[model samples]
Target: MKQLTLAGAIAAVCGTTFSSTAVLAQPSAQAADQSEIMELIVTGSRSPERLDEVTASVTVVDAEALQQDLQLTAELQNILSFRVPGLAPTTNSTSNFGQTLRGRTTLVMIDGVPQSTPLRNGALDVRTIDPAALQRVEVVKGATSIYGNGAAGGIINYITRQAGEDAFNVSLTQQVGMNAEETDDTASFRSSATIDGTVERFSYVFNATVDDNGVQRDAEGDIIGQALYGLSGVRTQSLFAKLGYQIDDDKSLSFTANYYDAEQVDRLIDVTSSINDGTKTYAVKPAPGQTFPGEPQGVDGNSNFVLQYRDAQLLSNTSLTVDAYTQEIENVFFYSTTFADPAAGFSGGNSVIVSEKEGLRLNLESVFDLSGVEATFIYGADVLNDVTSQPLADVRSWVPEMDMSNEALYLQSKFVIDDWVLKAGVRDESVDIDVPDYTTLRMCGANNVCRGGNPVEGGKLSYSDTTYNAGVRYNFSTAFSPFVSYSQGFDVSDLGLLLRAASVPDLDQVQTEASVIDHYELGVAGRYRALNYEFAIYESESELGTATVENPPGSGLYVPVRAPQEIEGWELALGLTVNESLELGTTYTYVEGQDPDTGAYIDARKIAPPKFTAWADYTVGNGLSASLQWMKVMNRNRFAPVDPVTGRYTGAEAPVEGYDVFNLSALYSRDNWRVSLGFENLFNEAYFPARAQAFTYAGYNTMGLGRTVKAGLTVEF
Candidate 1:
């Protein structure tokens, strides 16, 4: 019997080295909720077994169903893409913190901390986290013996919120909502506290959150002009803290800190246009910029910060975990320019770009069962440092600054038998690019004066790679299970803006770095008693990630790649419990991408069509509860990109034909106070051309806001 279950986990870690109640009962001695949590421990089995015997494919989100769906909004990737299922949520014109699942690139954490911030240019935005400070949201779809190498698209843990066995507890909440053209009016407030008993034994968990967001328009309420959405009344403020120490229990320690300051200001659109009679010279308004002398005219700021440390052990049956972290970010960009027609003349100038970043990470994990042939292991290291500076107005002939750095080391493993479960991992990363050295002078025509060039100093550019993953799993009972996996990921390129636009001349051994995908995935899942399910199918091929790429130097001469991409996908999820007051959930996703060089296909990767996402709730007896949600995105054929000199198609087309959005929520709790009311896009679905892009100078297609109404109220103690 698997060596008598590894000898009862080595007699419960040798009774936790002479028992302290066997180390506070050894993390619930295995199973407790979420249908017995599918017997999984040792995140990729560095030792503790039973995640259906491991073969990889995990996704558990249930902290009382995410605190009853956060009563309405806590974002978190729009509540895990409407209740997780092959995750998906991208393209509302890109970069809303970016979240992609089956399509790859996934890895978010909290508790096991580390919210990626390699100098702020990759993976982030678990919808600015706030599942009311989380208590659960596992998800391990793919890649891991235990996260090594940016988890190559899979693994999201946010299990915060602890301290229960209650001795002292409190909670409070507030809310208000209005949408369906009420103009995105909403409000929120929260409070929580929990303190268990015992002072000589030790146990504690503390959490905090404060959120406020409002400003969304579309369904004719205006604003939604796309391209990262002109900022919009963006506002955000967050703070999180965790402290744990249990000395007499075979070892344990935790200290976590989270700080996020979100800022938004998107209401600036002017993409070239001029006319004062002479027949209006062809429409297209807003274009007359050139200001940034002292800054202050529609500001900009992006921030990030995190700190964590975890140490755990259980010698007897084998289990150990260790992690260290440090992350920081500060990115600021401001723009406004003028230089189109000064009476048949022009002279450009106006800019402000500043970037700052710092990052460090270290990991180690192990799960044991040697002779019995069940193992799990992971090792890691990461580093990043980035800085950039630019402040200009009108024009200066000097450019060549930005220091970049990156480093990595990784290893992963997994193994199990009986019903089959096996997995593997490998990673090797490196990148270092630093630039400095500049000199330039220009002035031609009407006074000739252009000097020779060759000054621009500071050198150092490096690249390294090696990433891998493998998987397999099978189990025909306990609700059903099936899986398969293969993974690979890489990214690095922006060498100080591609060596200042390769203006030729021994451009240092021309090797603009390159690396892209060749991914494939397949899956299945199970759950019974009130039902639950999951599904997946995927294919990826890339000549380079991000398609074609180009949109760095002076946001003009545009082109965000679009000639080599092939994506195919599928996803579905469901949950039901229709009795004792009702509870239901649903999810669906479909993706398609193509271009393979010109077969054409890029309406923002088809805006994740194949829709249908559902949610239902009922619990009316004293404390009240009500919920409803629906979303459908399915309208293919949206293509617009083909004007290599008059081939016409000039942007915005392809099939923006899919749309459906609805939301309704209500709740009222008694004890610690809670009140929620939500109503989003409920019959005001007006999402114009989903993902529009075509030399965008802000000429439309950033739609998808329409109706929004939210409310909140929370208090716990």
Candidate 2:
């Protein structure tokens, strides 16, 4: 079965590349000579405006662009890999992980709401929403306006689809493909419709959609290892709705809602599972494991689960324009592992984990005109709540526990002066955390070895601080502008405190605290004639954070510790219109980070290597087009064995080599019908990530997937 899947994937990739090569040979003069108009809707702002007039950096990914790229192998983290400079996916050893922006301090938002949770985990899954349901994606690369807390790096806003200004319409799309590996197959189906009209004093528009997606695989017909979840075959289902009305000639009201549900079943891997009894070994199905508070034997866990999220927005403009929404998340995770001896200790129970989160946000903005100057003022407040619980006699023990609530209020203003734009904003944020005096679990003792501790007397720890930012932009011409900005970000450190308690002498001083980050940047952006470009240099410093080791220490259970770091990087992007039918674009990034005092390079497992990416596309008459893209990542130095006596990653590995990949894509479109084909990793370059120690006990590193291909079609009316 796996072999058949692998064969299909290989055939798909080769078929698409060969089938489209000839169609790409011709260029249409008419197609190359046309000019594009500027009518983009501004995001990260309380008002609407053209893209060029906006004061912040923005990257817009249109729907057509998403549909044309058939390979779709890359997730959100991978899309940003080559498309944006200075941002890379995280490559840690933990399960279900994601990348960060600008070393640290970036935020993820779904239609303006925070997607990251303080208690549940880190950020939300980047792949939760399908591009099929998106009108566009707007990325604001810096810390600016504060809606919710936790956005220290930057912000990513995914704008959902809405009803266009037209009569009733409907659209449908389907995609399927395979890779060079065996048993790998993927498929997806999506449909959407909208209706708009006016009756009497009211004009309304309504839109809705349904989406389902498949999965991808490796060359050997086995599921490839994802940095987040091991193995593969995860599916998702989503439904969306939006409504709008005209209140008056110059005023309007709009509402949007989205309900998303996704899940994945348990997938067994050959390498991670082991069946051994000291002198004897066997290959067999192992029992699932669970996490109990106090138990040493048995296996108990579940792999089936689902996540549901909903968001709603209401807006109006007159005296004050307000936007509000609420979100909730609930999930269950089950599993266990054998830590010490595999023979006598072969039986360890599984853990049942449950998490819940909810958040609310409200914002109001007003615009005023004074003489010849224009000023926009914005203010808002947000509240966040998180709860966690687990029940068991062993690893799945629950005594019913929860975290405290967090609240913040912020205000910002932007002033336009002749050819210069100035802006500043500040937020007052506070956190309240609750905990017991001591855990009932036995302490490791004076020997420095410990298990769970006594339950602590329940109490609340709260603190508040002010974070602000100031920026200025000078317009050199109607198409060019240079800007400089400095921003301060602050986030509560309860997670940091939890990790620090593992090694600290006193856990009381380890109460919830705050960490601050200072970011500085200078850049220029503009469009001249047929060329658009942006260049930026940035540096960010953090006061308190930590480099945690997820695995257990040899004898003593040493958790993570707090440390300071300084990160700096530069980003460059260029887009050129080579006539009307041809376009050329490229993005490049360079980064360096380290401890300020020691000057030691940061660990490799945390950051992406320096990389460069470029792409070119040519269009022929009718509906045929072709494109080629190149991506390369530099070799990275990582942690390896320093000495046989001490088991530690003190120095660097022998420099794991990097790789260069090439991809080709072609498309055909006519009126309301379109078809796309794509070939990825055409040359089948071989490479390896630094190292990961998640499912397995060894510090094993996995190889990247090789060649792959995909094809799809869409019809709209």
Candidate 3:
């Protein structure tokens, strides 16, 4: 649909301009593209293909690197952990909880519609939307049933903003920030606007964003609390619109709508700490002027609607695409005592996840040549209807109202022959759930002990599967080009975190079935002229186990254990242009998972350790630019807080002992005004965020986010 159109459709769809999309990934060989130049992915084959014809491993974070991640942070989980690279890291709260990507469980989307509530996975689906209404982001690393069900660690979509050629126009942006050490009541503000154009065949775009944050502080500056999901005094708003028409000339039609809201009205609280005496947690205020309790958590009223249609032939070589969507969300959590119930008069409680979804997608693509290879085919059909529930703002019923229905059918194929590339796919899922027998109350966690009320005995739960995939590639030239892959995924992930901790009296003894992930990958990429590179290694298995266990000790409540995991990882990306205004890059990721039967180390609450990103970019031309970035999250010390025969503390094992962060950005424009600046934790060191050194709960140890400064201004009319 219509959105970005700053003059000739931004050089015919983003060849660059609009003050150059806001720099950062500018220059520096663009890291993965290194310099061979050719990038385009419609989430790895929903359409707009390229990237040397896919065989997996795609990153793409453009839109001037999401405007250099809003100059420092606007929290899209810190803009996908500063431009995606194995993700994980970013529990700087509003609930991305343990942000994972390669570590598993990632299936977020915007344009492709689906914002993960995965049947009560209240981790707030990566803050729903609002990187000022995005225009770029696409990750597709592994595991996939090709957009159906939760992608077992892969897929991050989000691609909005379009239509630039201005038959009409308007744009504006503003920013204000705080807490460089002190800034009065903390200060924060943001504003964004965009109106777009094109007429005749019709095209349009609209976006609105507003943020209001304050109270952050960390690198010893104190206050950074809101309990395990804190950030302080939040307030976010976003709205988006798009429309398009062209229906003649092969066809087209589009419509999109989005809405988001965030909450957390902080007056501050939670000043408790005790990593068993190592101390940490903090966030102040509520004592001198009292006030902090109940209600007021995050996300509510999130929405998305989409309608699309495209044809380009419909037959005669075939081509078609259609989509219809409807979504809804309402996550809210953060009342603490984890959910106490001192007998039932309740001392604490907080829960709310009320998902809703209705979907349909159908696609078709075809080409010919078969015998000589050149073939292509992509077939699809999908339908979904979800309705979740989790109740408890006192309305009780921990996770009842199930009701799901899914259906899928898929087929994909591609072949080229000459330079080689072959791929295959298959899918055939069928799911149907329907509960309603409720009764599992009597809470109390965080060690307050209180067990469950049980009564379980829900009904109907069926899942069927037939996943498969295959891949191969070889362009062979410029040193390397290899590729290999295998994929499958079909999960019913957070069954409301195991039906509200059911004490199982029947739900079929609650093992809940449904999980079939299996992924394997291997890779190689090339370029020597300016050095481009990519390397991959992966393994992912699942006989069950997707992890989630936190029995008795420090119970921030978690449940679901089937054991039998096997995760593995590897990644490396390097880019170097060294000329053309300077560029250089680096990336590294290493993941580890265990427990194929007591091999241990499978819980850091879902594995993460060793990550790195390095960057450098420079341009001296008249409209100046600058960039620098470095991040690290090394060290790992799996287990041993006290478990020598279960003496407590297995709270997802602890000891991450890692930290490093640095950032800086700059930009300047010579016309119509555009100016920017950034610096986020750019050397204020004082660490602690690897989920506050590996999660043992207790407000997640806190700390991380000091040194801040952002400045921005933009105008266009």
Candidate 4:
């Protein structure tokens, strides 16, 4: 009989198994020591466990990997696209539209504090925190309810840096880069500093970062005007601080605060130059008095505060953890004239959506020796209140304020016997949303005819569901491990959007039902000599999957389509260590989804074509290391035809042509000084991303960035 080893499973989950030499390259001594012990604590696991002991498909990117060559970009979407196999490609904008994981929206968090506004997704959650402020990123694939609502796809948790045992430590980093082809106005600069130390029973870590981005240009030296209004030529600043106090050896308390701000500062207006030859181009014009020059977009401001307490030994073999957090987020979208109603005492400007959340979470875990089997039981409860609203600059309410409250309770048990591991969990969730009576905003049609302002009565909606999951893994030997799992997840629809556009007389009449998703997976992980590999096949089904559809063609009026959907996919990763100085790795991902009713692709733009990524790293001694990486995407012709004029897919489908790119990076470090250089799009390929081509209707058809070079240096004391 062949069984899987914990090591093999961890290798599979990470996509690239790190060799001993690679692990030794970690920056932190504590992390290196933990790697030696093979004890890795993961988010969503409720407790610390060995890598092999984890049953779910989880990917952990440590600080070293996060700073790797191909992942040096400031955009989180770009980094994740190249690293995570199941995630969609980057939209090249601040907004992560259609950037789903496993074809569903993922819940994003920072140190257990939610960043996503599920009540009304602003698509800006992924960019809330600067990558430099993170020590590690954990991604758990597949639908799971362990962390509560909005995890229909999976969860992404960003763990912040912690203070070391040293009395005082300070680090500083600076970088400057420019476009290789057009360097005139395409220069960018970034600076970051960190101070951390441990004194007596108190430990503290503080970090600050500032980034000034220049105009984005393509291979042809043309400015990429299709990007989000506030993405290019923008300034971003982030501040983070964490303080912890050790109360004896069994108890600890921590406080964390983070603030982020991003705004565009360029004074260029977008003027449509041409829309032909399967692409569009925009010229720059001087626009005064405009908030964002080209567009009336505003800044993005996000703030978070958290307090946590943990008791490792409240009782013998028992532990408890509690967390309280509050977050405020405001995201502004590009200006739109569609809602301009001068007759209604309102002139359309940029619209902004605000979301505020306050929550408390509690978890308790206990280990019990039951007969001959060792079991670990975990339970937790969560209470959260979210308030969200969308309003125009003219003080007109586009979407009225909505208050939502959620309560959840979950219980999980894990048992280990010999070479077998069994796990089961269940969660009960309750949700309530309140909407006040209001009149719809007056809107003008394309023909200059205005109609709207319909009175809608206030209503309240409540819903509840119970989800369950089970998994079993057998480690038949040190060479291989195989596992099977079934899990369920649920998400309440975007209530704020639903209520603001509600036409029904009563809330009960409207479909306020939550969508339930079920996931099934079979996976195998194995190690042979210096080679490690993992493969998984999975299927997800949702009876009431949500899809966006254009109700009136060319009118831009869209509505949600509730239909049955099924998605199936497979993932494979391989890693080989040729020697202590050289290593190679590769990953392949394939996913597809279909609507059960019409048998057509559901949200074609959301589907990522088959992708393959390969990388090689080598150390040349003298504290120097270099790496090369390549990524290729296969052509996806599985979509309906597009309308010539509107550029909208007739059946919610559009082709995504494929492209490949190469990258190179080198690093040199000695003593307290480090230097690094990275080259992106090494081949200077002139191509467009799938989203850019598929969304030509919005005049967003633009080419991707060309070859670029970046260099940075870091100093520590």
**Pairs in clash, predicted candidate 4:** 3-476, 3-480, 4-480, 4-481, 6-52
Worst 10 residues of 1 by lDDT: 19-28
Model 1 bad stretches (over 4 Å): 1-80, 83-91, 98-217, 226-412, 419-431, 434-477, 480-526, 533-682, 685-704, 707-717
Per-residue lDDT value at 54 in model 3:
70
For model 2, residues 1-717, the per-residue Cα lDDT tens digits are 011232243234332111000000001111111133244544545345445445455566655555554345434555555455566533421232425566554565666655554443433445445455576666666545364446656666777766655545556666665565443344443444444544544444444444333444433344444323432344444555566665565456666665555444333333432111011111112257732322321112111111212121233322344455555543323223322223323233332333344565555666667788887776777677655443333442323354657788887777777876667777788877665444432333333444554344546666677887666667667456676666667755425225323333344544345567766666777667777667777776666753444434322233343577677777777777788788887777666667676666665434556777778888887889888878776666544445445433332223435667777888889999888787766666654433332112232344444466667677777
lDDT of each: 0.50, 0.51, 0.76, 0.73
TM-score of each: 0.30, 0.78, 0.34, 0.92
Q: Candidate 3: TM-score?
A: 0.34
Q: What is the alpha-carbon lDDT of model 2 when measured against the actual structure?
A: 0.51
Looking at model 3, report the run of 10 residues with the lowest lDDT sum.
15-24
Instruction: Report the number of backbone clashes for model 1.
Output: 45
Clashing pairs in 3: 3-162, 4-162, 4-163, 4-164, 5-164, 5-165, 9-164, 28-583
lDDT of 4 by residue, 111-197 (tens): 888988887776778888988888887777788878877888888888889898898999998988888998878898889999999
lDDT (Cα, tens digit) per residue for candidate 3, span 593-662: 7775677767666777878887888887899888888888888887776856643354646777878898
Number of the candidate with higher TM-score, 1 or 4: 4
Candidate 2 versus truth, CA RMSD in Å, comes to 11.4
Q: Count backbone overlaps in model 3.
A: 8
- Relative to the true structure, candidate 2 reaches a TM of 0.78
**In TM-score terms, which candidate is top?**
4
